[model samples]
Target: MRSVAITGTRATGHRPPDEYGAIFSAYLRPFADGHFYIGGAKGIDSLALLWLAGNSAAHLTVVVPGTVLHQPTEAQQAIARTRERIQDVVELGAAELDTPAYHARNRWMVDHASMTIGFPHADEPEGGTWQTLNYTAEQGKPRLIVPV
Candidate 1:
């Protein structure tokens, strides 16, 4: 089982079909049933979690920045419910209403995983996704970029 960390923009507002397709094609295809570590958040993270939950992979871990229950968002709540079924979700810190120390949380994700798959070009100013990718690169970690 190869553990790969997934990250991306939460506000890119560009959830194109190809992006999800690429995730399955480029990342999930090569690995066996239970071999991915999904860093959970909104947008891309939620999508990845939902896909894996239905696919029946028992090794999926949803890593969140804070208490998953308190992370308020319709998509997040829905994902959280599905995530409970998976049984490997982890939270890194106390509950945060906003994105407090979120970038640091991203860095933690990158540091722990062997590789990171993300959408670094989906947004501007190099947000959490970019920081994570950059951190992984500096540490000589591998990366697979998802389409925007």
Candidate 2:
């Protein structure tokens, strides 16, 4: 089966809910039959999880740098709301929630997935979403970039 790793910015305040819903419907719907590995954070992660859970039959895996409790309240609530739909939750169990830990979690997801779909807000060279997309490129995996 096709498997995908999703990466995006945590800041998604600029857009309205309907815009995101439309974006997800167009981009994520094509891959709805595949398994998805999400970051389990705010922004695109939580939004994608919510949309996928409600709209698709894909196997969902929510991965975190730490535990779900350590994530933002919004992310936790998203996970809780979609608990039944999610097939798994992978907690890396990192004590320090730093950039390295997050990168590791991203890499872990990318390593397991056949491709990656990134929704970066801008052309940020140092952004985590960009980093994951770059890493996927380095690993010789396919990537679909969708700027939000």
Candidate 3:
């Protein structure tokens, strides 16, 4: 099956659990039949990785913003477990933690997938989720937005 990239807000305090579950099962599962592309971050990126973990046929590529295990956090450590469980994981390191490089990572994710799913928060324009969505739209790729 074709590959798809998943993107969304990191700060997801407003998202209801049921809503995320429905979004994952309904919007994420079909694309995750085989190889799937996910940026290495929290919230929806991590959630998609978690769901895709159960699908043995699925391959996951986690395009990261910095060096592998570069900016490790508690959440990222948890994601590292899921990453280890997956068949594949791709790390695209940024030279530094600059806005340009971070946005570049998002663009790279868009270029690799024909489809993207984004959960956008109204407040953050420079956020990775919004940036990824915008990049996908600019490329005219199919995109789904889960509103905040």
Question: Which of the numbered candidates is closest to the native, going by highest lDDT?
Answer: 2
lDDT of 1 by residue, 48-92 (tens): 667666655546776767767655484567565685665666678
- Look at candidate 1 and give me any clashing residue pairs: none
For residue 63, what is the lDDT in candidate 2? 100
List the candidate 1 regions with Cα displacement exceeding 4 Å. Answer: 16-19, 32-34, 56-58, 95-100, 121-125
RMSD (CA, angstroms), candidate 1: 2.8
Between candidates 1 and 2, the one scoring higher on TM-score is 2
Between 1 and 2, whose lDDT is larger? 2
| All candidates in order of lDDT, best leading | 2, 3, 1
Better TM-score candidate (2, 3): 2
Selected candidate, larger lDDT, 2 vs 3: 2
Candidate lDDT scores, in order, read: 0.68, 0.95, 0.73
TM-score of each: 0.79, 0.98, 0.83
lDDT of candidate 2 at residue 136, scale 0 to 100: 100
Per residue, candidate 3 scores C-alpha lDDT tens digits across 111-131 of 988888887765776567777
Clashes (N, CA, C under 3 Å) per candidate = 0, 0, 0
